[model samples]
Target: MIIGSSERVPLEKCPALVLNADFRPLSYYPLSLWCWQDAVKSVFLERVSIVSNYKRKIRSPSFEMSLPSVIALKNFIKPTEHPSFTRFNVFLRDKFTCQYCGDKKDLTF
Candidate 1:
């Protein structure tokens, strides 16, 4: 399906923070997220409930709705004992600080 163009949203701001049915983030390590398109799709599908909204609204000829800032699933999902390994996860699990010097900026793998 066609996604956004430059004329639409500024890509960076359109991401929604995805939460589990319990209302906590789906994944704390990665700061669970979904793009605007996916968030909107889930809303229409009744798979998620909007917990918060951004001021911006997207409009088409037939409808309009504010972009979701936060969303939670309708069904609870059990979290795994071991979260998947990923760059963001690693950073998050480590608390985003350099272990050696305690610097909180410019971290990298």
Candidate 2:
């Protein structure tokens, strides 16, 4: 999953959608994935990257390289934003105990 110098720019620092051979949308691929795979041939793009010269190349340390030089698939939907209320919920979920130091205190005047 190693992203080459070329692919880094067009992704716009965002995750990419990976599709199967059947063209069925599969899952999101982070930039790190490209770095991990080293090379990817399965790429289908809905909207091509506007930036020219954005070619992704993946290479394996074991002397293996994928074909198609990695495809630049379409951008997926944005992740849902976490609700602000979840912050408070998290505190209550852990009780009054300090998250770092699981201490339970009952203060009295």
Where model 1 places Cα greater than 4 Å from the true spot, the runs are 1-12, 84-108
Weakest 10 consecutive residues of candidate 2 by summed lDDT: 45-54
**lDDT of candidate 1 over 1-109, digit per residue (tens):** 1223343567467798999898988776558989999999999999999988877777899999887878999999998988788877777778898888999988887
Model 2, which residues run further than 4 Å from truth?
Answer: 1-39, 44-73, 83-97, 100-109
| Tens digit per residue, CA lDDT, model 2, 1-109 | 4434544454333334334334443433222234222223232223322222223534557653323323443555444475345544565666656676677664211
Q: For model 1, what is the C-alpha lDDT against the true structure?
A: 0.82
Could you estimate the TM-score for every candidate? Answer: 0.70, 0.22
Candidate 1 versus truth, CA RMSD in Å, comes to 6.2
Candidate 1 has a TM-score of: 0.70
Distance from true position, residue 56, model 2, in Å? 11
- Computed on alpha carbons, the lDDT of every model, listed in order, comes to 0.82, 0.39
